[model samples]
Target: MQATRTDQPSASPVAPPPPLSLQTRMVLLSYFAYFFYYFCRKHLGVATPAMVNSGISDTTIGWVQTAYGVCYAIGQFLSGALGDRLGPRIALTTGMILSGIASLAFGLFPIVGVLVIALSLNGLFQSTGWSNSCKVVAEWVNPVNRGKVMGFWTTCYIFGSIAANVVAGTILARYGWHHVFLFTGITVAVVGVIQGIFLINRPADRGYAIELEERSSPATDNTRSGFMLMIRQPAVLLLGLAYTGLKYVRYTVFSWSPYYLVSSIGLAEESAAYASNGLEIGGILGLLLGGWVGDRFFPGNRVRLALFALIGMIGAILLYRVTSGTGGLWGNLIGLGAIGLFLYIADAIVSGIAAQDIGGAENTASAAGIINGIGSTAQLFSGIVPIWLKQRWGWDAVFISFIVIAFFSCLAILPVARKGKLTKA
Candidate 1:
């Protein structure tokens, strides 16, 4: 008696497993979506000086920057809820479209209030990028390949930031701020349509079982009374609070790097922009190392990977300080670029890789969203940090603050490290 299809052994060669090629498309689409999201998210920082000359007061402009963060926080809460239920594919695509519109509106009319609305709208949509990507990665890949795949996916932010900084700086200088917004808006729209058509929500949706069958459908049911259950979760709370300090460093570097160079280091506007791109390049390399280290040696140990990131971050900070203080333009370039690469790698591992480890597929988005939201909220200090430090003492205070925060971020993970949990068993 031959075994039927239903009775075929899990190891049966004839039964044929699903191709992971769809998973490959999912990764590419998901990553490119994030790449575009960051492009939209980051262009404003580059355009700040331009906005200032357009009759907006520096103080008022700072508040405008804050608007992006305010919206980002709201996006964190909403995107996760949507991804957990509606599925990542829809959530991510819709977000790209919404952000595309807001980006255009912001470019067309540059009013602070209107731009705030647009940023909020953009934030709302942009929130889904990470969450949806997490869902795609979680559903299709398993423990063994997750580190490398996710690590590769993690490079997109640096790549996105590098492209935005280089392109936005040159373009804004040549074509003005409006053109930057218009170009990014169109780019994001194109990415959105392409990803939506090509990406599937889950492996099952593409007629495939999970790579390792990570979990069952009913078991993935994480629906609960909104934030109530979420807050109660230890892992969730830790994810948010720990990352808040980390965000301060991340946003401060991004939002203020240009200003730091121009105001403190005495570099020209475009030069500062160029220096900042160095950070993104370092980020790309760091992420590559992060993934390899995480999967190869540590295996399922997320905290260990995070700890390794903590060490890299310290080196990154030293470079940031030395480079920013130096008079040579080349020095600034090397230092700032190092900062961008290492710091970004640290974050990529934390949210993109670690969060998925803790939450699994069903709740991957929710986990990432909360962590990202908490970090973005640290931008509450983005404007004030520079102003406060400048007024109270000096520019050195800002760098010192980042150094302290970097250590604190590492120390904050004591709890996470103590409990060595794995997604599998």
Candidate 2:
């Protein structure tokens, strides 16, 4: 009977593991979706010289860019609403497939009218990538870490731009500019199919129920009646205003810097493409630092970091202007890198991090659409503004205008910097 007595060991309670796979997959799919989107968007910058050689005037090319910008801005609202309603999987996959077809068509057709139409369609479809992807990422991530998370996530644009430049430049060297478009198109189409097969629309879609548990909160009261209410929040309005100016300067560089190097600074076309890569290369650092600063120093207050970035951008633009005149190739390269660093710091903070803070998971797509749509509208003027100024007042005026825009953009966010702090999860 004594031998039969036995004791059992006690067991401690165990908590469920975190949904790391959900976030990992969300980040990867969204990253590649936006990454390939740039393939269609950026080829125009590399192909401008070829376009000019084929009889497209600089003004005509500007108009073509404007056409894309106008359509893209409008499409942002539509596609964003659709993404919110239909889910990311459908919106993004459809957009990519169409954008790929459009890119392929852009390469095949050399006629100016036809090319304009193709680029416009490409712009429309490409608009789907950002807002939908934003919605998806917002659902899986918490606001407390959004700055750091989105900071790294936003690098897709920088890396995508760099990759497009290298690939396009290499193809321009070996196979020709048309092949650049062809290669990128095929790549985008392949990525689109992969995303469609693998991308989950949200945490709830895959049995992760955290979002559902939080549905009782006010932020998740995402009915049509509440949509406008959320979008009109002070953070959204102020960030949107600041982003307009920031996006103008960003698009100016993306649209015409290579052409400026070739025409004003006398670099060869391929060299200009390679040099433009420096801007994005420097942006990688800016984005990482911006996220770190926002998370570490400001926490929920992203406007403070954005204000700093805006000031830095003004100085960098002025320095780059001077470098263009006297610093020679290496100097200009360094200057461009600095400008990119500062510019994207502001962009990653305001456009990527702040938008998520204001929108939350439920309203993120709409918020992204509204802000990005308004910001992109500046592209309409960005295409025409610098070109007109360069034609009349010279490159000095063109650079000065960017300084003025940065000054105002900094001012736009000051009130938010003083009054707002983003909420934690």
Candidate 3:
């Protein structure tokens, strides 16, 4: 009773949030950051026909792409671990600036060896954007709305690829491949500066509580140990495994679709780039629809929705292969778009949403790194496999191989769906 007496501390009023406008700004910056990353990366694919025409061999191209893929995959592990330590803001800004420099250097030289070094470096820098963006999204968004939010955000890459094709197509039509690299590289660097100026690393930095309800967990640990801990979890490992196949197929599409259209389907080089937008358009639709389905129909169980999309992807890829030749231009567009839709829906759900749910706030970057890094390792094969299959068995076998992968990828996630709890890492 000695201190219980008269004077009670006055209750202070909690300040109100600055409005959704701030959140919108963060999301927009992140979207553009990723958009530019893809723009810098994918325009090279659009430029490949010209590069090949410039006396670069298909075998050389495969080697160059493999170099990039290897560096990109390895960079994912290193940057993801460092991102957790240094924060997304610094990591993203640094990556964007360096990637742009690398792309610019790639355009300045036409020699195969030099081009390989520059593009490989570009891949190394570009790898930082994925895990850092995942970390940023997880910190700002509540878990309850992560599916829908991430779905909308995932469109950046889809449309980025579309935009890259369109812009790179126009550039190649008018100026040539070098200008395409020069222009896109410069744009990415400028955007990186803007991101450094405006992007917030986390909601808590602005004195706001994260909107998601916290799950029970122990105290936070250091980045290295935490990363190792998260990677060991069964959910993370399975998700990563499924992602490997998904990325293998998707990267094949992104890297080779334009070339296929030009070489096999008989479209002009420029026209192939434009037509390739069908894949991205399909991706955009799939991501939005899939996100809504996950949130509205299966909020507590996303793995089921992912499985459905995977099954649909197998059907879609087969349909695309069947109709690509006989379906006319519009049929090809529609079929390619359908393939994009199915493949990306599964990608968005498994990589983005699952990582957020399973890894929680503390491990989002680590999980993203593990899943995306492992998946990206498949890119090494994206070039190698296509080259081997096309060289030995032809494109028909390549498509059939992808179909087989889709079936197996679906099987990888079956246990996750059965558990019905993507959050249980």
RMSD of 3: 2.9
The TM-score of predicted model 2 comes to 0.91
Residue 211's lDDT within candidate 1 is 47
Residue 379 in model 3: shift from native, Å? 0.5
Off by over 4 Å in 2: 1-18, 211-226
Return the TM-score for each candidate structure: 0.89, 0.91, 0.94
Is candidate 1 or 2 superior in lDDT?
Answer: 2
- Model 2 residue 160 distance off true place after TM-score fit, in angstroms: 0.5
Per-structure clash totals for the candidates: 6, 0, 0
Off by over 4 Å in 1: 1-16, 213-220, 223-231
Q: Candidate 1, overall lDDT?
A: 0.73
Q: Which pairs of residues have clashing backbones in candidate 1?
A: 278-337, 279-337, 279-340, 279-341, 282-341, 283-341
**What lDDT does candidate 1 reach at residue 363?**
69
**What's the lDDT for all of these models?**
0.73, 0.80, 0.83
* Tens digits of lDDT, candidate 3, 149-194: 9989999899888888899999998998889888888888888898
> What local lDDT does model 1 show for residue 364?
73
- Indicate whether candidate 1 or candidate 3 has the larger lDDT: 3
Output the TM-score of candidate 1: 0.89
Candidate 1's displacement at residue 420, Å, is: 3.1
Cα deviation of 80, candidate 3, in Å = 1.9
